[model samples]
Target: MPRRNEDALNFLLERRSVSHKTLTAPVPSRAEIEVILTAGARVPDHKMLEPFRFLVLEDAALNRLGDAVADRARALGLDEDKVAKARFSFDNAPLSIAVVASLKQTDMIPEVEQTLAVGACCTSVLNAALASGWGANWITGWAAFDEPFLQDHLGLAAGEYVAGFMHIGTVRSEPSERKRPDLNAITTWVSS
Candidate 1:
């Protein structure tokens, strides 16, 4: 018989994301961060493509990225408030892992499946951080979809794009449980 991990299941059921603004420094050390990434990289991959990679943003990198965001904001004619808001995301997080999806053209697996694998990597990173006793949240804003921002700031290559940013840090406070999807309503059973 397969043994069940009740605690792991419980943690998933009760998981809550710590807000980006609430996360503080003294984030996961390099050693621990490596472990988190290791866990995250173990997600499913069709044809074992490994079509994803990570870019860690911390300290000076955060400042650089924030400046880039501010520049993009100004170029886009966004008001000061909007620019600040955009920069805040990068400046505030103690550390963030950029899960980048780089899809490859292949006959074996569909490009969409490769992209979905990248999405799974993002979730995997989020879960890994949470499981390792760190506050974590997966986020992506206008900056994520902006090509110039990604290329110039994050140094993403031609096919590379941000799947999600997994913010990791010390948990400031516990968050109240929000509503969950009605599984029964969403789930449909079909039998032949």
Candidate 2:
């Protein structure tokens, strides 16, 4: 019989991302952040491509990124409010770990699979932070999608993309429970 880890299952079922804006000071130390990164790197990698990397943004870096986003928005002639909102995640969060998807030129593993691996890495980082008693949220806003902003601020390569910006810090308030999708409606059993 397989051993049942009810506690781990419950944690997974109950885990919900905290808002970046609601996160405050007391960011994780270098060692603690390393732990989170290690956990994140544990994600499954088909063909062992490991086509992803992380950029740890703290203190002045966040503000610099915010400025870069705003500048990109202005250069693109986007609405000021939208531009401000695009940078809201960086402006409010004490620390953010940017999950960068570095697409590898591998015939064995498709580019789509590599992209999915990066997304999994981002989720792993979020879960690691939450399990370690910190407030964490995975975000990807307009700034993340803006190629010019990413190239100017993050120095992303042509084949790379931002999978997520995981904000981590102390929780300011208890987040209210949000509605979840009905599993019955989404699940399908295939017996062939």
Candidate 3:
């Protein structure tokens, strides 16, 4: 039998994403971030088809990304609030990572499964950041889904799209816990 790690289980039980707005400076160093990204990469890849990649956003890159989002929103004639909100995610974070779901055609793997792998990558990245004593938030806004925004800003390929942006940095305050799902209400069991 494998050994059970109670400490790991406890950490998972208490993990809560910090609010992006409240996440401040002194983000993870490049060396530290490399460690985190490496952890994210160690996930199940169906048929050994690696369907995801990560883009680190820090310092000047954050400004470039935020400005592009802001510009796109303005060009679309979005209202001030919408425009501001669109750029805020990228602008506020001291560091972030774009988890790109870049799927390639493969006969052995279904498209849905590829997407699931990317989604798993997103969670893994977020968890890695949180476990490393950093505040993190998983975010995807209008900019993430907008074709023009993704193309011009993120440079996503024809079939690629963002799984999520993990906003990671120092925390200003401990986040208030939100309501959680009732596991029993959402779960179903069958035995024969």
Give the TM-score of each candidate.
Answer: 0.95, 0.96, 0.95
Q: Worst ten-residue run, lDDT, model 3? A: 152-161
Off by over 4 Å in 1: none
- Model 2 clash pairs? none
Candidate 3 per-residue lDDT, tens place, 1-192, comes to: 999898888889999999999999998999989989998988888887889988888879888988998888999999999989978888898898999988889789999998898998899999999999999999998887777778877788876778899999999999988999999999999887
Model 3, residue 74: C-alpha shift (Å):
1.9
Which pairs clash (backbone N, Cα, C closer than 3 Å) in model 3? none
- What is the Cα-based lDDT of residue 173 in candidate 2? 96
lDDT of candidate 2?
Answer: 0.89
Q: What tens-digit string does per-residue lDDT give for candidate 2 at 1-70?
A: 9999998898899998998889999999999999999999998899888898999999899998888788
> What are the lDDT figures for the candidates, one per model?
0.89, 0.89, 0.89
Off by over 4 Å in 2: none
Candidate 1, residue 30: lDDT: 89
